[model samples]
Target: MNSPLSPIDFEDKRLKIKFKLEKRLQKELQALTKDPPTGVKVDAESIYRNLSEWIVDIDGAPESLYEGEKFKLMFKFGSRYPFDSPQVMFIGENIPLHPHVYSNGHICLSILTDDWSPALSVQSVCLSVVSMLSSCKEKKRPPDNSFYVKTCSKNPKKTRWWYHGK
Candidate 1:
């Protein structure tokens, strides 16, 4: 069991998940800070609750529909963080909907949902979301966005997604 005062050991499932996330986060920070993706910038990041949640600030892709946007996204690490999947979403105002995004900022991606696996890391999720934004050429949300927002079933991990097509 984890003591109140001592840091949880890596062997502990939750603590282990947290440690791996932190390590991945550090590596991503180093890579992005040195060579960030086009139109995406990292503003801030943090890990808390024995690594149960990670908060990251990102400047949206420039000149795109999401350009000039600042978003705060939260990644909720479950007990089965890697084995299962981390829940992620935008947690601030101005979370717009796109073909791949629900109004709630929950994303639609295989890696973060059905296709997720232990081999993937936090970096992949971030890149995928960013790529998702960059892929948007319409500069607008989907046509049936409102309906999808209301009726879409969340991923098995309880993530909401705006599926663009059947």
Candidate 2:
């Protein structure tokens, strides 16, 4: 039998990256389901290498403005992955606008960028987002949240999100 570790005949780097990401995602999913967060349900999962997108469905919040709501969020992982942070956003048309979330569903969180470390996992990110949402007291959004969509760009591997508080 051929060794499973042998590389497959693929020329596209993106394909190779996708394979790795999918493999990691599968393991992560298994582990997550084996020990899911309290009151949270995962509805779907998919990977898109070309677009660098990872789609996840979450049903209900343990705390926050989104309680009792089912939402779909997108995470865009960069080449650096664990070393750097992934870009997370909300999808769909009917999401409630929050201070930390932009109009296009992009989220502004410290851990997803500046505070990211390899020690963190996908579960941590999800939990953090949940906690952030849960803590919201006002239904309105941030003052300058609209500018993020215009200023933010997809991570290109080298860019690092600033972690220090302003």
Query: How many residue pairs collide in each prediction?
Result: 0, 3
Expressed as tens digits, the lDDT of each residue in 19-115 for candidate 1 is: 7767765665567657765544554443423345666666677666677777776777665656777887767886755666667566667777777
- Return the lDDT, model 2, position 138: 81
The TM-score values for the models, in the order shown, are 0.64, 0.69
Least well predicted 10-residue stretch by lDDT in candidate 2: 155-164
> Could you give candidate 2's per-residue lDDT for residues 1-166 as a string of tens digits?
7654434444466687767766776666666667877654453343423335656666546555677776677777677665667777778865556777667676768877667787787777788777777777887766665665567664422334443453
RMSD of each: 6.3, 6.3
Q: lDDT per model, in order?
A: 0.65, 0.65
Q: In model 2, where do residues sit more than 4 Å from their true spots?
A: 1-23, 43-52, 60-63, 150-166
Measured by C-alpha RMSD in angstroms, how accurate is candidate 1?
6.3
